[model samples]
Structure formats: structure tokens, C-alpha cells
Target: MKRFLLHLLFWAVYLLQDSIMQFTWTMSALPGMPDGERIRLAIIATVIIAIPKAIFTYFVVYFVFPRALKYPALRWWLCGETLLVLTALILAHRCLNFYIVGPIIYHNIIRPTSILNLPYLLLTIMDLGFVSGYAFTFKLLRMQLSGKEREKNLLQEKLQTELKFLRNQTHPHFLFNTLNNIYALARKRSDKTAAMILKLSKLLRFMLYESGKGFICISEEIRIIDDYLELQKLRFNERLSIQFHRNIDQEGSLLAPLLLLPFVENAFKHGVSETRFNSFVHIDLQLQNEILQFIIANTTNEDRIQPEQIGLGNVRRQLELMYHDHSLKVTNAAQVFTVQLTLNLQSHAKI
Candidate 1:
């Protein structure tokens, strides 16, 4: 609407200027037109003449402008096309003057000096007013749009950087704590310490390779979670309880690279590992119809209260950024920590 109004105003200005030009030429050609009565007559006549041409010119410019241009070689093409549009306008003006308005309009009652010959002067001013002005306006609009695109891209890149940094932080925090446990066993020369190292290496490989990317297969995330649970189980021996069930109906479920792993990792990190004896974590991932459902619940020990948001805070940020208003449910109590995240993997985008 604004553009339409602006175009209307632009045409109004051009028509007013064209009328003035005609009035100036007319008064000089015939001195009788300078008197008040004759001047009013010329104004009325000029308005009738220029108004329609101005409205027509506005439509031509608005509808006929082209885009989708790229490359230095194509610059010449645009320049040539622009000239052609202007030249066409000039020819249109001449045709309107010589054929339509001239012969039919100012037939016998109108003096030859009274009707200004717009066609004669149109070619001379075509380059100055028509092509150059329009080309300049087009370049100006293109530059403004380019700035907006640049800002959008910069914002996306910033979010990605923050996400990666957050993921990187989660990796080291998990490893630092795990290595501390392994270090304790290594000092005592425990046999299980070697197995722990191997498990840790596999976890590191996952974090380094697959998890580092923008997205990952859901099956891959589950596998990594299993590896983590198995490693933690070796440390706990048979004292720990775990239930992990996944329905293969959504076999090719796709998600952000490290989406579910962080939640699972957080569950075991704070939930099961807080107190030594008989703690449990329940994990479920399945696809019913087209919806992907993931749930995690872990027993939290009140007596050995851990910081509520160690790994969970960053994971929440990542989830919000990756899947804005999708579907996420989280419940945490003194005794139990739970996360129920539902994502339509069919709607998930490949990064």
C-alpha cells in the first residue's frame, strides 16, 4: 500500500512538472497565453493532456521493472534493457502527441502554437530524466535489501556459534567428572579402570564426530545414550537399575545432533549418580503414528542434593533455539527428574 501511494505521488510530481514545461513553452510560443484568461485555459488543457500519460507511465514503471540479476556481465544487459524501457516511453510519448492527442485533440479550434509538441523534445531528455533516475532508484532498493539479508545471515551465524560453544562446554564438563572417577580407580590400579577408559574414548568419539554436526540420526543418539549408561553401569556394578525402551517404527527419526543425548546424560549425571545405592533412570523413545516421543525419568536423592541445573540449563537453551515452540515437557521434583520431549521428526529440517 505504501509503495502504491509512493508511486502515485511520484507520478503526480512528474505530471505537474511536465505541465509546467508545457505551460512555459506555450506562453513563450504565443504571448497571448500569458494573460490570465488564456493562461487558465492552457492550465486546464495541460492537465487533461499530461494526467493520463503520467498515470500510464506509472503503471509501466511499476509493472515492468525486472529483478533476479547477478554477475558483472549481466550489468550491461540491465543497462541495455533499462534504456529500452525509456526509449519505449519516449516513442509512446511521441505517438500520443503526433497520432492520438495532436490530430484528434487540437483539431481546428486549437492553434498550432498552442499545443506544445512533446514528441520533438522527448528524445533529447530521455537519458537524463527517465533511465538514469530509475536505474539509481533500483540500485538504492537493491542495496537496502542486501543489507537486510546480511543482518539475517549474521544473526543465524551467531546463534550457531553460541550453540556450538554451549555443546562444547557440555562435552568437557561431562568428561571432567568422568575422568575424575576413572582417575580415582586408576590410582588404586582397579581392573575396571581400563574398561572405563575404552568407554570414555567411544563417548568422546561420538561427541567429536557425529555429535559435532548440526543434526544426527535419532538411532545414533540412542546408541550413544546406551554407551553412556553401560559405562556408568560398570562403575555401579549391579547396584543400579535402568530401563531403556525404543520403538523402531520411527527408524529414521532425525533430530538436532545432540538434542536427546544431553537430557539422557543429564539424567544419569544428576539423577542416578547422586547417591550410591539403588538409584534408577527410565528412558523411552518411540514413534507412535508420526509423532516422536522421548521421555526420561531419574531418581533424585534428597539427602544428597545436587545442583539442579548443571547440564540441564544449557540443554534447555539448545532445545529452545533448535525447536522454538514445538513440544517440550519437563517435570522435576526433589525425588524425581523427568523430561518428556515430543518432536515431529517428519517435520524436522536437515541443516
Candidate 2:
């Protein structure tokens, strides 16, 4: 209904413009006529002439424009056809003005001239072309806007699908590492296996429920990291030294779920688990003024470090997909591997 009203408004404006032009032309041609009679003739002539203009305008905008876009090879043929139809409509407009409107206004039968009066025919064509040009410009603008909207929607959908896929990859990669720890404890018949299983259950519950959300409170993610560290502690005991320091000014800040876990998990998998000697994993997290900074440094035995682990790669892609205003830096030197990530939480807070 709103669209219909807009179209009605456009046509009303066009008619008013045409009527004014006609009134001025008639006033100049018939200077002796009264103002009231001149206005009536202008309005009657405009109304009668608008019929062919409307047909030609709609035909060019709706019919010819779409076919030209769809079939480029037939453009010349379409152009010829359009010219023929336009000529026919111009003749119809001339005949209607001469036979129908002339007698009504002048109260006398008018003599017919050659239907091929080049000057008058050209004037009619110009009149029809004026309105057709407006209609075509409007149609082109609408089509361009609609195309941009569709492209934006498609890009959004593709981003979401890729994010979901990355999350799915993180879930299993995390699970496999934790389950291996549990399996090792089970083989030894260690009493800590049951406690680890309980902690694993809680972590699984969080992953199943909270991880599905696009964003969650920073505190929730901290809690998940705590549970995971405790589960790892049960496996490694005093052999691994783990330190977590947090200086959070805002506990309720929101960020993408499961975004931080992969770094911590990477520290454990490549640092603590691979080392035969004592190893240390230090994590520092700070959130102030909606900016979150996370740094994780861990000891590694290998001389050369491979930072692109599957878990780290997945988290890197997730970060790219979820946060536009975030940066991640990875460094390896002197038997220590480190990952530093900084995020602008406010950018994704509303997502």
C-alpha cells in the first residue's frame, strides 16, 4: 500500500507539471482567450494526451528495460521495436488532440493535416520522452539499491556459516585433548580420574549450552577456563606450574564465546604435555574500558615452535570472523612460545 501511494504521488506530480506547461503554451498561442477557458482547455488537453504518454512510459520501464538487461544480444531489435511503438503512440496522441479535444474546446471541426508532420511529430516524441526518461531513471535507481541490499545479505550469511564451522572445529579439538588426559588417568587407575571426569562434565555442559551463543559475559569464559585448568591440574599434579592473572575492570563485558579457550588449550598441549621436565604456562588477562588484552606464554622443549596448531588456527579464523577491531600476535623465542591477543569488546557487544 505504501508503494502504491508513492507511485500515485509520482503520477500526480507528473500530471501537474504537464498541465502547467500546456497552460503556458495555450496562453501564448491563443492570447485573446479568457483565463478560465484557457485553464479548462489546458487541463482537458493534458488529461487526454496523458493516456498515450502513460502507456509508452510503462512499456519502456517495465517491458523494454528488463528484456534489454536479460538478453543483451537482442538490444538493437528491442530498440527498433520501442521506436516503432513510440511513433505509433505519438500518432495516437496527435489524433486524439485533433479529433477529440479540439472540437470540445474550439466548438468547431478542425481540418486534418498530414499525419507525418515532422515538426509536430518530433514535439510529441519529445513530450513522451520526457516522462519516459523520469520513469527509466527511477527504475534504474531502485534496481541498483535492491542489488546492493541482496549482496549485503549474502555476505552476512556467508560470514555466519564460516563462524559456525570454526566453532564446530574448536569443540572436537578441545574434547579430544581433555579425553586423552582422562584416558591416561584411567589407565593408571588413579583416584583423580573421577574428579577429572566431574570437571569434564561441567566443561561439556558449558560448551553445549553457552558456546552456542554469539556473545557471552567475559566472566563466563573465565569460569570455563578455571574449570579446564583445574581438570588439567588433576592430570599433571605438581609437574606443571600454571599461573593465571586477571585485572578485569568490567566483569560483565561481552565477547564471542569459546574465543579464548584455544590459546590456553594450546599452551597445555604443546607446552606442558610435550615436555618431560617441569614446564610453566603463564596467562595474563586484562579488560579495561571495553578493551580486552590476553597474553599466554608457555615453555616448550622443541627448538623450533610451530604456532599454527589446529586449535590456534581455528581460533584465529574465529577472531577474524567475529571481531573486526581485534589483533593477535604470536611469538616464539628461546624455548618459550607466546600468543598475545587484544580485542575491542564494544565492537562486538551488540552482536
Task: Name model 2 segments beyond 4 Å from true.
Answer: 29-44, 105-116, 349-351
Please list all clashing residue pairs in model 2, or write none if there are none.
Answer: none
Q: Give the TM-score comparing model 2 with the true structure, all chains together.
A: 0.90
What global local distance difference test value does model 1 have? 0.69
Alpha-carbon error at 12 in model 1, in Å?
A: 24
How many clashes does the backbone of model 2 have? 0
Best by TM-score: 2
Candidate number achieving the greatest lDDT relative to the actual structure: 2
lDDT of 2 by residue, 1-351 (tens): 987897888888998888888788767667788988878877877888889999999999989989999999999999999989987999898888777776765554332365567877888889899999998898888889999999988988888888888889889989999999999999999999999999999999999999998789999999999999999889888888999999999899988898999999999997778776768889999999999999999988776664569989988888777778999999976588899999998776222
Encode model 1's per-residue lDDT on 1-351: one tens digit a residue. 976777667656755665566666666545654466545555555555454355444434443333323355565666676667656655555555555444554443344332235545554345236634663575468678999989988888888888888888888988887888788788989899989999999988888878867667677887888888877787777877888998967656667776777787777777787766668888888877657788988888877545556577887777667764457777767778888988766564322
